[model samples]
Target: MPTLTRRIRRTAATAVAVAVAAGSALTLTGTAPAHAHTGPRAATSSTVTSAQLTAGLYQSAYSERNRVLWATSAVGRPPVTRSSLLKVDPGTLQVQAAYTPPVTDAATGAVEAVYGIAVDDEHNTVWTTNTRNDTVAVYSQRDGRHLATLPGVAHAREIVVDERRNLAWASSFGDGTVVAFDTRTYKEKKRVTVAGTQPAGLALNERTGTVYAADLGGDRIVEVSPYAKEPRLIPTGDGPISVALSADGRTAYTADQAAGALSVVDLRKGAVTRTVPTGAGALSVAADRRSGNVLVANRAAGHVTVVDPRKGAVVETLATGANPNHVTIVRGTAFVMDKSAVGPERQDQAHRIRVGR
Candidate 1:
């Protein structure tokens, strides 16, 4: 196994390489902001509000059952010492409760910091990806209590829950595999491998029990069906980091970080039908069910671009904070987590945008 330091360095190098390949000059340490394309093309009627959260905020999920939001945070590089799971009030964006992760090494004070989060409302639990420690953990959504930690998830990037099937699927970016676990037992149930692809973000189709993974390294989407013997691959644009499914499940949208575009894939045809230019460092995407508008988080541009699938154009641009890492839409509201620039004084923030229909 590679040392923690080596793993972190490798991941950073890969990210830089991907950015360059996608024709972007952005680097891990570079703080230069990428300009967003705005004008009459952008929407002028969207309401956006923000709140300062803790540092190192990476991703967030909304729990319809609990009526709250869950987020994960981890500060510093390898040997990360500061990390917490936060429960926030969706309306006010206030931190209702915070739970610290258990220390892994007593002498060194190392912790299993989490980076990605997903909520399983059916079971009233939350799942988090401990990317630094290569593991996944479950927690109680009611009180922010630790439930269980399952190890051996190499570089876990994202997780999604299938409440109907009682399963949770996680993507292993380092090993190009998606592993499934029984939600009730928290045991590894199946592992589906997508050779030569680094799976980053995951989206599940509840109606079909099919999981779609964004292939960051291969520029494609890996489709894993419950009944299929082999997974299917649908080609996408350069450096597709995150993905979202349309309301009808007929189209899949990808945030191509390297290309600074959103690739719309026709699920039935298994091909990219359109590539719409979004902005630089498009890290995450979410589809609003009410208006059917797709929201893309542009990390380098420090804004969120709202696109109308029917028109194939950007309708509005909402300026988020620096480094918008992830966006999740819940009940017609979009929650964006921004990991404000790299520094001790720079606190992360969460933005709530009401994407009007």
Candidate 2:
């Protein structure tokens, strides 16, 4: 775990509050439908073929909506132009929109080093954790227009929104702190410190109003209750890089990148109930809410493991691009961020999976 230190010093005095535009759903705009399709739908009932299953895993729910897959190219030398939001159609697995972050001179002006990206589905906004600028950039998901650069966010890394409370929480790797901001106004409301060297990922169960954070260096998951007075630390596998929760909010899965395993934590017990062998370098984990399957993106192995959380076992493995890193599960699609070092820019490919019981 990296020490929480002041790595980025803010020099600008300007305060900016950008509001991402909430554009109309682009369901009928392109060749693909307008709405985004998620998870398994009623039309996919037959015994699916191998190709169909793979396509189903990646298919969009809203045939009316599209999934935007974004990749950060900072891992490349000379900082390759890799930060791009790739809008993919689940039906055809086709690229609909390729949005690239505008390049800026960090030496003179505000620039973003995006570590994580989250979709504000309700607002139709895309929020990004800008580590370099120490802010969250809100953009309109439909048209790729900048809404506002949220000021006052410190070392924003992994961010999650609690819809029930209408709040966003960002974990600060530099401060070992998690700060809560009002989603409607982007105002910091509270900050809590975690007993870890560095925190990696965060998940909020809107149903329970419970916040779970994977502390990478502490080898634990810090459970914070917005309704309670204090937070609790639950021991987990080594170096949990990412986390995801079941739709019902009873199960939480952690991807232990160092241990090369996936840790399934029972939310009720607040303890790890099972550890299943995934491929080496498990970087990200996502839950197929409809199927009760946990998907892991193993960076070093260039593959993904589909696990049955009930049995604590790996049920299937699918090959992916080189160095697959981040993952997000929306509806029926699992958008993979494959960061491959290729020349001045890193190549990121989005792969879909059909998740079925």
Candidate 3:
């Protein structure tokens, strides 16, 4: 896929364009209450609840140490002037505080807009991707204070922190590279380039210090190891935008956006074992370690699909909101962040779902 096309497909905030391009056939409108669409064994509506948080919500991360949720949002298109880093209460689904990024150009009202977010529990900081600025920013998890802005990243997308290694790894979608930074010093440590691939979402195997990146353009997963000279590639379903590993780290799950499916890959074999159709524009995915289930955010389909990896089937489809961008699992609970639908009154929302087996 071309870089431009991949960019459009990857951004759920631009819902209309993505829906049309992906052939979602969604009738996006104002005052359209988000509803749950369940399968035969789907979780009931009682298991899911939503709260209108803000507009342009992209991704969220749960801080285990602080027991809080950190979210990122960037308003409008390019030259994005307004953006915020929100500290949310995980249990109440309430915004505790919001912090604005530092202004880049006063004349244009451009600030360091953040889109993707990750919590660094070991360092007590939050890392976010400044996509427009081609950099990554760090903030204090306790008080939401701007700590540092590291530049030179090309279209930074998703980030993951290795608490055991005391390092943060961010995927650069524009240049097909994943850069590692030392959490303690806030300095660049290494840059691993994946040739001819646009790396989007990232997952880290803390046990081995291996990083797995979803190649949005290449339709594969790039495995980067600290000791290896080159990254290895594992083929997956079409347009694998987001990736997550099972609790045991023996398998990988990818939300295949273009194919609207979940590609399950066995890490030891380095091959996709099954492709489970999720929903339209399957975007983000997270594995519930406790339940051993995989939750996928179907952006165009306007819901989150809960898949039983053992059965290789979608057991439940819970409607979150329009353009569910990402899913983050903490202690068996799933937090879904969705962008605004294609309407004036449609606003972004955060959903807390008790994903029970």
Candidate 4:
């Protein structure tokens, strides 16, 4: 999966070509995201010591009220066979529960290649993206019971649950769009056509009803709205693998893997305000809603930097195991998952670090 981030690093000329052919999909909206802010900010440094939370982990979905984490496990990369999901305790680092979703298609007997996982805590259900099968599944978050299956999302990457809207959204990298569905009945809602060959990640602001897609091929972040006829596409740094929007939905921080930096985008201005150097292989990003800190996983550098978006600076660095690509803060602890994630084995697993204030 290390090379997956490099799937769309094109020359500037090549990128422009893609944009022009697709009707301004790649049109550079703002200047390249700024790498620095106005004045000298306070130099803040913090490191988090960590320990293993257990194995059999992949993409993560967390529940604040339940204090549980739902991370997926796959046997194969695509069309994952014999895979399952584990419900984990963030505080104790113990697997509280586990559920193996049913094979989605009976004719092909296609096993769920669960990639992007999200939880609807309000309804006690879990939504998962079956990338291999081009489908999405919902199960009981309470007991792992199979609830329903919704088809039509192709090459699904990550999913976001909009609690406010009672809707779930999945990014279709292969199809070049984002699909939304009803959280309760698994009904099709809307499909947001976005730019890039790969929309590797998705971030949502439930309050604002704004969704941001990290367009890797197009090298930009596309602001998605259900009400708007056209999406707000803003170009950013190279190899944008993941995106995270601020609590206010005014700032969007994109993890640019090829550029090895974090692109800070001003949502309202539709421009990149700053580009902060994170480290090699800035793959995954998360915006801490409670603290307003942007957590980035530098996979090659083997550390997670807690970035202060307002100051455009990296304040804390959490040293962890190698190839730390995926990161999320669940219940006060920052759990970093490695891209080289293998089966339930602990030898190559990642450590969950306690994020400090």
Candidate 5:
């Protein structure tokens, strides 16, 4: 598999041209139940759109009722590298803009390691987790302009911000804890220790001020009450690497990366309600908060499985590229980071797995 940085670098230039021709929202699977979503549409369908291939990582932004994509590509090898962000229209799966993060260190001139990118719709800001630097970099979502660099975060891996409260929570891989920051001041607020071991993925039910953290090392999912003095531990599935919360905040989904299974945890009961088998090597997982379908990106299988959260059943499967690492579902389409499938000569080739009504 190609490194995330390598993948992003390959697709950088083409993303811009693709963005100019972009149009409507890219549809994924149809919304399921009142809380679930149907699987991705038929494989042989007209929903196909030409994609702007890139080398690094892509994150979906649900803004203005249209699903836009923001991708960042890294240059150079491991320890340090330069990265630029790009805007994508899910409807056309085309790149709109290629953006640069704040150049904090004139000597470095790039982000140390951008692991996760998230958007603050209310504040119109986009934040990326600078994993190598232990900081979060903020940017203007509208124009892809650099805003500020927040330093001193402890091993931040995945982050989600609540614009209403002007706060962001990050799951720290280094400290096995959750760190809270005030978005406005870019300063630390609370460092809450979760019951699980190594925290990996993060999700926030902004409606209830509840944050869900997946502790990969502890093999469980932990829930933290943002408004409470001390957050509580609600046992989840084993080897849960990523978590997704429902729009209603009544249910949560976790991708058991190690076990190749999906776990459903009910917030009201604080206990797991179901576990469903998925493809091998389920590395990244996502959900449609509005519809409630759990999308699992199986790295080894090169396919994504859509799970009906209500029954814990596998509803649909779509093939992807090799070593599919990240899966982000916006209003209609699901953007996957196919780090390995694209050939050395054509690293910008990634499939746009569309799911529609």
Candidate 6:
């Protein structure tokens, strides 16, 4: 079986163009539950638009200071030699610029691949998880110039930076650990490893100095503490590929891929509060800070589910481009890593959905 990265990358090759639609607001009259999003179609208040991006699209990060989005694209196998770093305009859903991260090993000059990305607006920096070489590279957000590289992270899959904490965290699947570093000094601070943990997706709440890790291999979400103590493990469903934390750091959301549900986890208690049946192949989830909505990507279903705070139920389902793998929200707009499955005509794209304030 192909690795998940390769499988997703291969799927991008056959993407077809899709019509982006405005998200409608949904209201569930049933019981008001935190995980009350049972069926699809909510009161939609968002308008969706998609733009065909460079192929091999994977993960995305947003720069609030620049009002733009940064996406990572990878191609080639094993030691991936080619990858595209794209800068997109959120309003128009257009690619403003594209650059390739330096994937060659600096000391040995070997080929490598890039996976996850995060934007540090406070430092004017862009970070990419150089997977093949076990390193994280920092680039200039303005010009996309590779500034520095910090190597030695094992199979880094997802990355998150907490400017308030002045620390950046990367999830290492190969080693079952989460690596934390000082963003200002570019120094390795500590590596938090939990037994049986294969961390995949990472989310951070700088305000509370809390980090959430989706341990895909462990079937749990581990709360990694860089300051002290062992990681807190929150048992989840079968396979959790991605995660999103509320701004207040009180609640967490996961795209439980294997379980085909959007799980609402209470961070304070480290337990799953509710599980909404999203669909098979739900890959990533993003929280809307402004409206307090959880946006879930249904890769197999070809739609984005909006879990509104209203009665804690799913209020709307917005149509997106095929295979919406990852999503992030900036202001009132959602930047979705939407793509098409393997086919003759592929419309692999980065889609932007506009939501009401």
C-alpha root-mean-square deviation, each candidate: 11.5, 11.3, 10.1, 13.9, 8.6, 10.4
Worst 10 residues of 3 by lDDT: 15-24
- Report the lDDT tens digits of candidate 6 across residue range 10-64: 5433322222323322111122212222343434456666556666788889775
Report every candidate's CA lDDT.
Answer: 0.83, 0.62, 0.84, 0.71, 0.67, 0.74
Clash statistics: count for each candidate: 2, 28, 0, 3, 21, 19
Clashing residue pairs, backbone N/CA/C < 3 A, model 3: none
* Per-model TM-score on C-alpha atoms: 0.88, 0.75, 0.87, 0.81, 0.80, 0.83
Question: 153-243 in candidate 5: lDDT tens per residue?
Answer: 6777788887667788887778778888887777888788854378888888877777888888876677788568876677787788888
Question: Candidates 5 and 6: which is better by TM-score?
Answer: 6
Error (Å) of candidate 6 at residue 31 is 33
lDDT for model 6 comes to 0.74
TM-score attained by model 3: 0.87
Local error of candidate 1 at residue 232 (angstroms): 0.2
lDDT of 5: 0.67
lDDT of 2 at 292: 80
What's the lDDT for residue 217 in model 3? 93
Task: At residue 154, give the lDDT of candidate 6.
Answer: 88
- Model 4 agreement with the true structure over 115-184: per-residue lDDT tens digits: 6788886677888888777788898877888888788888888888887787898888897898889877
lDDT of 3 at 222: 97
CA RMSD (A), model 1: 11.5
Residue ranges of candidate 1 with Cα displaced over 4 Å: 1-44, 341-345
